[model samples]
Target: MANDEAAIKSYLAKYKHRDFTTREVMSLIQVYRSLTYRLEVFVFNNGTRKNLLNLEGTIPVTYKGAVYNIPVCIWLMDTHPQNVPLCFVKPTADMTIRVSKYVDSNGKVYLPYLHEWNPNGSNLMKLVQSMIAAFGELPPVYSKPRNEMPMPYPPTFPTTFPHPQYPSQPGPTFMPHVRPTAEMPTYPNFGLPYPHPGTANGSQFPTPANPLPYPTFNYGSSPEVAGGTITEEHIKVSLLSAVEDKLRRRLNEQSQQSQAELETLRRTAQELQEGKMRLEDILARLQKERSDLDKNITILQEKEKELQSAVERLGEQEGVDVDEAVVTTAPLYTQLMNSFAEEATLEDAIYYMGEALRKEVIDLDTFLKQVRTLARRQFTLRALMQKCRQKAQLAC
Candidate 1:
């Protein structure tokens, strides 16, 4: 560690006399100080003002014979002799080194005071020298150049034309173009003039004449006369003509009513035809169902009879009496009897048959209603028919 410190001191001494511009010195000081504290320096060129310096990771090498872990920035003044301000140590990897011209509250730029490094206090001289070695030279101060010469003035002009394009052209002419007439205007009067033709002025013209003359009843006058009297025969003829017109109107009205009634009757006939077709279909379906029921009843009766005979045979084989077995199977026999009971009186049987028929009709009506609903929903006829057959068998 002693050897490394001595080597850092020798390197810093070599850069102490180096010619460095103010900006370069400030950048090098930041890097040098950061390295002395064992903190890495990352130089970033912001492309404008002061170049930024970022402290990242750690600096393992010693600088100016001292070790530190804190990071800092060194800002340079813009004018005359360059100086720096002591900034707080940052714990982050990157920090901005702001270069600003110190200004008073009146907005005037002021030169910053130079700081002297104490060897016993902080040994900042060695770090500043090392910073000068790393960064080259400081930038020169800027100022505006002075201006000379006065501005030129524009020329003046008179308000009259100097020369004309067409010297012989005529001047503009002005005159009134319209002339008045001597005829007087006329206004219409509201009332008609008496003892005069059509106008209030005394002019010889036709007056306001009545459109129709009173009718006369003189048949003796000429038949081709322009204005003639009416006779009793003409009155009779006119009355007959009016009566004929009324009769024709009544006949036309009756004809229209009759045509409407005919149309209603046609619609009623169509509905009745459809109802008849539906009834025929229902009757056919009922007949088919009755046949199937009869077949099923016969099959069930045969099975029942076979079961009774088998029970009797089993009882006999077990040494039971035949009369006792018959008595025990009497209920089964009665059920079969009830199933085949066709000897009821015609009136009673007819009544029961009518009730059964009514029930079958009601079932058919319900089925038709279901079918219509399915049809309205666009279900296939074949599918509906299959479902209906399955449901009817299950009901049975």
Candidate 2:
């Protein structure tokens, strides 16, 4: 498990956001150990080349009670999660690409999930699960005829190892490169109904009963001696080879078991971490609200005490002066308010003078003269009021 994490971290060192992409790839491979990661030059539609990280492997899909490993490669862009990875089916020499609505002739995959990809919601693990489910419904590739042509030698390793020849072009074309040895995962049964064993045909061998054949050694007679006694060296070599093969198979199984257990622990730890963060956030918000509530309660208590003091003071006094109670904040405000009151009084005086003139209490010339003088005084007061309001920043 430590080695796996180290490898993942090393591969993700060149990514823009290493911390996030590392976690994503680690979790993905932990669950699907068959998948291997690599850095390769990805070619764009416009003939641009970029060295990018890609996870390549076969996901098992069950069809008609038999499970088939669907070879696939998912290419991650520099800004992964922000953009959907380019996915394609990678068929082997023994397999043929089966074109369908979901898969194009070039083996490029199209799905609703990829179309509606959300950075926060989508991930490699879910994408792989979706692929498995989709391929199960419609098998992507079928095995070619055995008699048409055969490989010179049977593969010693499982086909889960990614083929080295991934065409650099935009299409999913296979070219030739030397294949590397990779350990086969003793896969846990996953998917709908059928589980992938990560072996050839998902079959198990019993204790290496028929180990790989070794050439018979004859030292005393013709090389074609049929009934010749085998030497101790040959016997020892045969026994060692058989034991080594058995130990290798055991180690592979144990390694996969350990990997599965480690993956489960990692998932649990992640869940606990998330829960801790949620609890911390909730606690912080609650603390802030509590502080605010305490402050409001203190203010209300102070207000109650002030109201009680006022009630007592009013009870003690026979009368309260409303004018004294209402105080202006500034001397300028006091002057402005006094000016408004005088202007209103002058308007009332002018109205009364006009009334007296209408009742013939004074002559027209005297009435006109008194009214003009009063009007001039009132206009002066109105101008002063307008200036005061402007100075006080109040609307006229």
Q: How do the predictions measure up, each by TM-score?
A: 0.23, 0.40
> Once all C-alphas are superposed, what RMSD does model 1 give against the true structure?
53.5
Best-fitting candidate, measured by TM-score? Answer: 2
User: Tens-digit lDDT track for model 2 on 11-119?
Assistant: 7677776778888888987776667787767655345566778787767665554555566788877777776777877655555455544654346676667766788
Alpha-carbon lDDT, every model? 0.34, 0.64
RMSD of each: 53.5, 19.6
lDDT of 1 by residue, 286-385 (tens): 9999999999999999999999999998788757675455442355444433332322332344455457657785465665565455444333433444
